[model samples]
Target: MFDGMVKIVLAGPVGAGKTTTLRSLSDDEPVSTEMPLTDGPMGEKTTTTVALDFSTVMLDDGTPLQMFGLPGQDHFAHMRPIILQGALGVIVLLAADQPDILTMCSEWLDAIQSITPDTPIAIGITRSDQARDFRMDALRALLAERKTTLPVFTIDARDREQAQQLVRALVYSFA
Candidate 1:
């Protein structure tokens, strides 16, 4: 049972589908800070989140969950602490097709742990459909090395069902 709102942070590298995940799970139209991409490796993606993406969804018990997605670019690192404030848990999405996927995951995980060591976390590997030879074991090994045992799922960020499943995993971690 929840009294007020439960906050969750969605964090990851550029083009990792954080915004799409929020849009998929949100009950209403999500508020986005997306701007036209100037120069980046995001390919055809014309826009990228500049500050953050926000949305709210109600759980089966009628509790509202506030989802905040942080900007993925390195330049926005300073905003991470601000966005993470009072967050109940974190959903770290990694682009499986990214060349530096492992490195990005490590960086994000480090940043998250540095800010909220006790908060629960779930890892969602987005773009799995485009990744050839996606290795779950490797990711699990990496988390094991960091001494974190989190629920990891291969998900399509645009799919409502998959996104909700990821959110549910994070919420259940609190229980």
Candidate 2:
């Protein structure tokens, strides 16, 4: 039933693995960073996603996904409204180890809610394998307090299959 292209934005805080997630799902090698950082919290990292990064993939029903990833920084927050203009949904990446993740999720939820209240939003808790596994109930409760009713799961960004499955779950929910 997904005929026309679906634009999906991946939003999260810095080091939440937004870039890595974009790299994993696309058919291609998932294009590299576009713009360079002049002066930002990102500092002078060799790899910095300044503007927005994009990649695409076909759904099982032949629908095209115009996957767009936004730089996970307050400086880049301005781009969300524009990038989310026609987005079908969003994949919000969150690194549990980072204490600021809850704040990041809250901010993004507020931003995206204004654009599309019904827009499907899924949270991916990255780096679960690195840190002690947190309770899924606690994670769900956190999201519930923000008024976001969506599935939240732990994910390893490095594993292509696991990452793809998480995305697939989100897509399937839309159906």
User: What TM-score, over all chains together, does every model reach?
Assistant: 0.92, 0.82
Per-residue lDDT of candidate 1, residues 1-175 (tens digit): 6986589999998888899998998889899999989885467688999999998877789888789999998898999999897899899999888878788889999999999988899999998887887888888889889887789999988899998888779767865
For each of the candidates, give the backbone clash count.
0, 0
**Model 2 lowest lDDT segment of ten:** 37-46
Candidate 1 similarity to native, TM-score:
0.92
lDDT of 1: 0.88
lDDT of each: 0.88, 0.76
Model 2, 1-175: lDDT tens digits are: 5766688888887778888888887788766565555554452233567678898887687777789998776887788888888787788888877765666677878888888777788888887776675456776777778665687778887778877766776776675
Q: What local lDDT score does residue 45 receive in model 2, on the 0 to 100 scale? A: 37
Highest lDDT model number: 1
**Candidate 2's TM-score:** 0.82
